[model samples]
Target: MPVIRVEMFKGRTVDQKRQLVKELTDAFIRTCGGTPESVQIVITDVAKEDWGGAGILMSDKYPDKK
Candidate 1:
């Protein structure tokens, strides 16, 4: 089994996530020769306040976004 973890700011729609997982599974199967059913994908959605970059909170860094 192959496990894939993706962490990103929370705002993506269900369709986007579905497409991402499908494409990821396809790529893994093509490169690693694994069944799509055996591939595990975990997506972690974090709020801008919970994530930090460049020593600053993302929410504070980009106040224009929600």
Candidate 2:
């Protein structure tokens, strides 16, 4: 089985996330020749504050902060 983990800044619309998962899963299936049941898609959405970059919180750089 293949387990894929995708991490990104939170606040994406549900549609976007779903599409991303679907596309990625499809890619894996195509390359690795696996069935949907054999491939696992895991998405971990992190708050900008939880992710730091270049000595600054990602939230500070992105307008996604709330």
Top lDDT prediction, candidate number: 1
Model 1 error, position 45 (Å): 0.4
**Can you write out model 2's per-residue Cα lDDT over 1-66, one digit (the tens) per residue?**
889998988778999988988898899889889797888888898988899989998878886524
lDDT of each: 0.93, 0.86
Steric clash pairs (candidate 2): none
Kindly give the stretch of ten consecutive residues in candidate 2 with the minimal lDDT sum.
57-66
Cα lDDT of candidate 2 equals 0.86
How many clashes (backbone N, Cα, C below 3 Å) per candidate? 0, 0
Q: Mind giving the per-residue lDDT tens digits that candidate 1 earns over 1-66?
A: 889999998989999999999999999999989799999999999999998988999999877534
- Cα-based TM-score, every candidate: 0.91, 0.84
lDDT of 1 at 25: 96
